[model samples]
Target: MGLVKIRVEGVSKVFGRDPAGALAKVRSGMDKTRLKDETDHVLGLHDIDLSIRTGEIFVIMGLSGSGKSTLIRHFNRLIEPTGGRILFDGDDILAYDAARLQTFRRRKVAMVFQRFALLPHKTVIENVAYGLTLDGVAKPEAFRRAGEQIALVGLTGFETSYPAQLSGGMQQRVGLARALATDAEVLLMDEAFSALDPLIRHDMQMQLKELQGRLGKTIVFITHDLDEALLLGDHIAILKDGTLRQVGTGSEILAAPADDYVARFVRDVNRGRILLCGAFADAGLIAAADAPVIAADATLESTFAAFAGGAAALAVRDWDGRIAGALTPRRVMEALARI
Candidate 1:
């Protein structure tokens, strides 16, 4: 009926000599040395609660050591949670044994790492088919499927090329193809575009957004970049030290940050770029009249550029050229001032 793919409950992960004990801090005690000395045993994640809807691109963002990676890792059981539960489509993923988990990874969930995890010697087709092969898909069938996936990621003619022959961005595209080949419902991307150069990164971000828009795959995207989060996420969840700081749409966070940390994170952002023309229009500032209009879904950045000569109010007309409302530079500037 609807895609409500990944759901996470009171998930918590702790690395320490006594992981179970570290779930909650105890007073200075007999095992102080054990708790203090072991670094990995320390709690990496607190009681984290989140629900990722199917087909929605949910972004998890935080700085380094904030448990962003750890929290994401828990989704696929790469790192087992010391406490709580993870459910995939109402199934308790934690209860799945190796075979069931392997099946799940193959068919339902796929991950793209920061480092393109393609086999260096394998050709692009071979890399994309690796998952299918592991899942017992026929060699020839897997190869054919891989070819289709390669084409989907815009690596059509390079199917026979090795990972080394491709640029970093291309290699990452290969990685994406490999994941897509599985037809996985949930795509967990851990800083997928962080490794690319600025220009390349922007291209990759746009590509991923386009791909997601077309494929409608549920994505749990992890990133340290606020701009990236705002650009890609349908819903943004800000995590600080393994705890959720705030969760909302990009504009909601930009318009009203839940706390100082989130406020500071988006403080310098240009709201004109982050918010849509509809937000300003809905503020009831625009006087409805026949004038040039931009769609409600258009970005402020794009809409502002349309009014480059400094118009009083650009009419937000519909597709049929009927008057909807107006957008003013003053409203845009006011919204941007909140960031």
Candidate 2:
């Protein structure tokens, strides 16, 4: 994890004519269901506290009405909280003036919506360059940057293609390219892949992971799908009923759920795919000199072929390249057997 890029403290949002009053009631121990029934005020979020690290994919996930989308919008101040403070790099963004906020939205953060909000008539390059043009960048410079982004997103030949002419996945690539063209430090993706077909969504997820590895943008990805969240997020925050349920790495949450709700949420997940070798490895055991080596962060599923090849045990090496421990085939099966 990098330095904290965005910090959300005591953030709560209520939607109604009497937002302040509703917030007060919420703080005074009114649950979301009762508050809504009594005041007709929807609790969008409740006391959300989060730290989004720089250059990491932070995923917020939940079912419908879980406030995942609401929480993400707070980062760019698209929707202000009724109470609490949002800080960007230790500076309170909630205090920004209109002009400062405009600059912050344009230069610091970019968003990719679920529906691929591209201009219908605009060509791919033009759509990608739209943000820069809004920032008063000259046409030539904006077009050049946009062209680079288009190519970066594997849409090199589609610069002149209109959104209507492109497939759903291609249109989404245009959305991503447009966000990247702005050179924003952070990317806010709200259900960005949810609109695509399953295969296309999987492809987009892989592309996003690859892009994050190379660009190192602080990405806040909102998804309702647990699989997508585990695949992309360096750290995942689970929300329920407008309240934060838990926040941790996917493996951490899988190994030890914060509560029964979280446990049930993760009950169907494939443990072998999420649990790391280091967590399951035996520190007391040592691997043979000829044993296969796997990274500590490698998923247990990735070691199956080695185990099938008659390797009784594999050496688990950490990120720093030191042998952390040895992972045996029996341990892998034991982990898979765990619900």
Candidate 3:
């Protein structure tokens, strides 16, 4: 609920020569598939309305061709929209000409790709410094800044290694480092961790969460995996066939799905992992609370581990260590059942 960093209003994209007619048809209640089949116009997005908050991880998730990638490209104007407009910090992005758009891309935002887009010939240090170099930072100063980012990403000694010499995860870290070196206000990550192995992907997810907490960068992350979105996103936007289906926190999405598509999508999800400790706590049940105090932000997984020895209820405390609410095993199970 801070200031809005990016606002997308009534955004729609149709890829074809005669987009005006197709868009008019769409507004008249025509669907995307029928339009494509009957009019030969492809609908890449339809009325996408989103507000990305400052310094928060806003995740856009859907299967391939769902317009998740296309929607994000508009943040940096990579793909010109057939209709609608986007606002960044109150400035109209769509109205920017070539020079202003270039400056916006260089200073306001940096992107990390699905593939590790590192230079095969350049050393890791060189790749990380490339963005700064492009912005006209002197070589010595650029290297100094890039070296700090490389260390921040835990790739200190391997700065001399080439992309081929590093592992997939390491290369991905290089991509992250390169983006960080730019010192941009926002990070647009399009399925950045999807290419890694499952274990490595999870590790990267945790690292990104920690880094976000420390750096407070506004990150717009794209993903196809529901679990990854639930784990990493402060707010999640679900897209289906180029249309937005739902937008809310993970718990909100789980407790109340907006439509049948969303309901079926989350029907088999492991809800226990995503539910937080705050969900199970009820202040009125203080007398029933018989266990140790736990942090309000702790997840059910950690609660289970902490109370593994018994079935006692726990007392939840706020950041200042003051009693906030009471938690019970039964309440936790009941919350999971609702999901």
Candidate 4:
């Protein structure tokens, strides 16, 4: 994990008249249901506190009305908080003037919406270059930068094609490419892959992981899908009824939920696919001389096939290829059972 890039501090949002009064009642132990019933104000978020690290994929997720989208919008100040502060690199963004905020939106953060928000009449390159053009970059320079982003997103040959002619996945790629073209340090993706077919969604997820590995952009991704959250998030934050329930790595949350709501939320997740072998490895155990070696980062699901070879234990190697520990069949079974 890198240093904190975006910090959300005690942020609360209420959608109705007199948000301040509703926030006061909320601070005085009133819940969302009560606030809504009494004041006719909807609690969109309550005291959401988080630290998003530099160059990490921070996922904010929940079911409908969980305030996941509302919370993400706060990062770029799309939705003003009823109270609290939003800081970017230790500077309070809520304090930014209109001109400063506009610059921040253009140069510091870019957003990819759930819908492919591309111009139907514009070609792929034209759409990708839209941000730069809006910022007054010359046509030739903007097109050159946009061309690079188009290729980066694997849309090289589709530069001249309009969005209406492209498939849903391709349109989304154009959206992603557009965000990338701005060279913004942070990318806010609000359910970027939710509209694609299952196979295409999976492909886009993999491509995003690969892109993050290379570009090292700080990405804040919002989703309602647990699988997608686990697959992408370096740190996952779960919300319910506009309140933060828990925040941790996927393995940490799967292994130990903070509350009953979170416990129920992750009850059906495939633990073997999320829990890493390193967490279950026995540092004191000795592996057989001829035991199979597996990477420490390998998921428990991937290690099952190695265990099927009749090895008593598999040697787990760290990134540097040194034996970190040994993982036995019994240990794997115990870990899975605990979850």
| TM values, all candidates | 0.89, 0.96, 0.92, 0.96
Q: Which of the predicted structures, 1 or 4, would earn the higher TM-score when compared with the native?
A: 4
The local lDDT score (0 to 100) that residue 40 gets in candidate 4 is 100
Per-residue lDDT value at 152 in model 3: 95
**For model 1, where is the 10-residue window of minimal lDDT?**
26-35
Off-target runs (Cα >4 Å) in candidate 4 are: 319-322
What is candidate 1's CA lDDT for residue 38? Answer: 54
- Model 4, 161-236: lDDT tens per residue? 9999999999999999999999999999999999999999999999999999999999999999999999999999
How many collisions between residues are there in candidate 4? 0
Give per-candidate clash totals: 6, 0, 0, 0
- The whole-model C-alpha lDDT of candidate 4 against the native structure comes to 0.94
**Which pairs in model 4 have colliding backbones?**
none
Looking at model 3, the pairs that clash are none
Write candidate 1's Cα lDDT for 155-242 as tens digits. 8999899999999999999999999999999999998888989998899899999998899999999999999999899999999876
lDDT of 3: 0.91
Between prediction 1 and prediction 3, which has the larger lDDT?
3
lDDT of 3 by residue, 223-339 (tens): 999999999999999999999999999988988899999999988888878877775689887735456888877777777875686758888888787788887778887877873
Angstrom error at residue 79, model 2: 0.6
Candidate 2 residue-wise lDDT, 1-339, digit = tens: 789999999999999999999999988998888988998999999999999999999999999989988999999999999999999999999999999999998999999999999999899999999999999999999999999999999999999989999999999999999999999999999999999999999999999999999999999999999999999999999999888989999999999999999999999998889999989988899999999999998899999999989998999999999898899888888887773
For the record, the alpha-carbon RMSD of candidate 2 to the native fold, in angstroms, is 1.5
Residue 213, model 2, lDDT = 91
Query: Against the unseen true structure, what C-alpha lDDT does each candidate score?
Result: 0.84, 0.94, 0.91, 0.94
